[model samples]
Structure formats: structure tokens, C-alpha cells
Target: MQVCNVCREQTPKYKCPTCKIRYCSVGCYKKHKDSCLPVQPPEPSGPEVKPASSSAVCTDPWSVEDLLNEDDIIDKVPVEKLQLLGRSDQLRDLLRNPHLRQLLRSVDAADSKEDAMKAAMQEPLFVEFSDCCLNIVEDGTAPTHT
Candidate 1:
């Protein structure tokens, strides 16, 4: 069964034509449509202008870490590390892994945050996801630490 991309609930009823995110309900689709636009690279207008240095890189305007600073109890994971999870292809692929689905169920069922984290880290996909995030940060694309 297809999972709703909005809430991760099973059996999404519709998929967005533009971004392809599957949604379970009309409300979810409407709520998510605005932000679900694709992240396409800007097209060149005329003759392409090249940057002086190949070292220049694209980066997110805001740090995900900064967004998490307001929550303490749930923010035990450092922003630096947490920031990496959503930036990589590895984590994207891991989402479809059946083993990860089980791991996530175990994580959500854990009584404590520590226990959830421990169980999540034990899964190979989580480890790979963490590594992918680290790679993104090291690649100079993530916003600089404050």
C-alpha cells in the first residue's frame, strides 16, 4: 500500500502531478501543495556566466539547527548532526527500505528518547543517513554553524 507523503500514513489516495508527493486527503494535499514545489536549478538566460572559482557552492539559506534551538528536551541530537539527515540521497533511498520501516516502528515505540535514538542508530540505514548528512555539511553546502 502506498503511504501518504504528508503524514506517512498508509494508502495515499492521490499524487501531486507537479512534485509527485502522494497524499491521503484533500486537506493534506492543499496544505502541502504550496511548499511541495520542485527545487529545480535556475535556468541560464543568455550566455552562461561562470563563477571565478569552482569552490563556490550552493547552500540552504537557513540552518535547520537554528530552527531546533527552541526545543530542548527533544533536541538532544546536535543541530549539526541533525541538519544532515534531510540533505542526502542516501536517506531518501533509505525511506523505501523495508528494514528501515521496522526500525522506525521500533523507534516510535520506544519509551524514551534515548532508547529511540539507540534503536534508530543500530539500523544500517540510519547510520548511512547520518553519514550522508555529515557529507553534506563537509561539502560546504549546509549553512555555517553559528
Candidate 2:
């Protein structure tokens, strides 16, 4: 779990828009906002260089890879597949449901994520949401469920 950069206590619930520093609460966010500096994008090196292998180094400072272990990297989905989730109308519609969103939030905030996921799986709406994401990512198509 990622601790708040401000308090270094609780798990962070939100990220600063400018610097992308994680903060747990509104108070922490308010405290951080005053001192937050916008992160500068990295400058490209002279020539266009390509990695010899598919295992290229991740340059983004705040990438999801930063949260993952080396073993997890092996099962990580490609950016192209993840991008398909955003274009999925089925996923957008599923996300519009407050109950599904709450279930997702509960799962995210749970101390035991595995247990939380198992509980969430019992909910039909949550299952549908999971299926929609899988359909989009795996097939690169929105679910045709009616």
C-alpha cells in the first residue's frame, strides 16, 4: 500500500494534480498543495534510441510499474490493451453505476485486497464490471452483453 507523501501515515486515496504526490485526506492535500511543484517532463536524448529487447526501462517516474514487483511485470498488460478499456462504451456505462463504483472503491481501500476481491466477486454488478474490463482488454472490443 502506498503511504501518503504528506503525512507518511495512511494509505493514499488521491494524487496531487500538479506534482502527482499521493495524499490520504483533504487536510493532507491542502497542506501539500501550498508546497507542490509541478513535475517537469523528461527531455528526450539526442537520437531516437530503441531497446534491443522488449524489456525496455520504464522512464515515467509515476508509472504503475513502480508499484509492481518484477514477477508482476511478466503478467502486465500492454499499454495498447489497457488503452482499449478507455474506448469501451460498455465499461463507461458500467462505471456509471454508483454501486459498482462503491464496490471498486471498497476493493481498493481494503487492507486485504484478496479477501475484498473475493467478496466483490459475489456481487453480480462487480462481476459484470470485471467481465467488461476483461472483454475490452483481452478482445479489444466492448462487451455485447444486453
Among the numbered candidates, top lDDT falls to 2
Give one clash count per candidate, in the order shown. Answer: 0, 0
Query: Per-residue lDDT for 1-146 in model 1, tens only?
Result: 55678888656655565565667788888889879786464788899877788766424232354334332232245556556656545556766788877777776556564678886887678887566556665663543233
Q: So what's the TM-score on candidate 2?
A: 0.50
Model 2, CA-based lDDT: 0.77
Candidate 2 per-residue C-alpha lDDT over 1-146 given as tens digits, one digit per residue, 9 for 90 to 100: 56789999987766665687778889998898899999896898788798887766544344563355343323467789998888777888889999999999998778667699999999999999888788778786655446
- Local lDDT at 88 for model 1: 49
Among all candidates shown, the one with the greatest TM-score: 2
What is residue 25's positional error in candidate 1, in angstroms?
44
Q: Can you give the TM-score per candidate against the true fold?
A: 0.34, 0.50
Worst 10 residues of 2 by lDDT: 65-74
lDDT of each: 0.63, 0.77
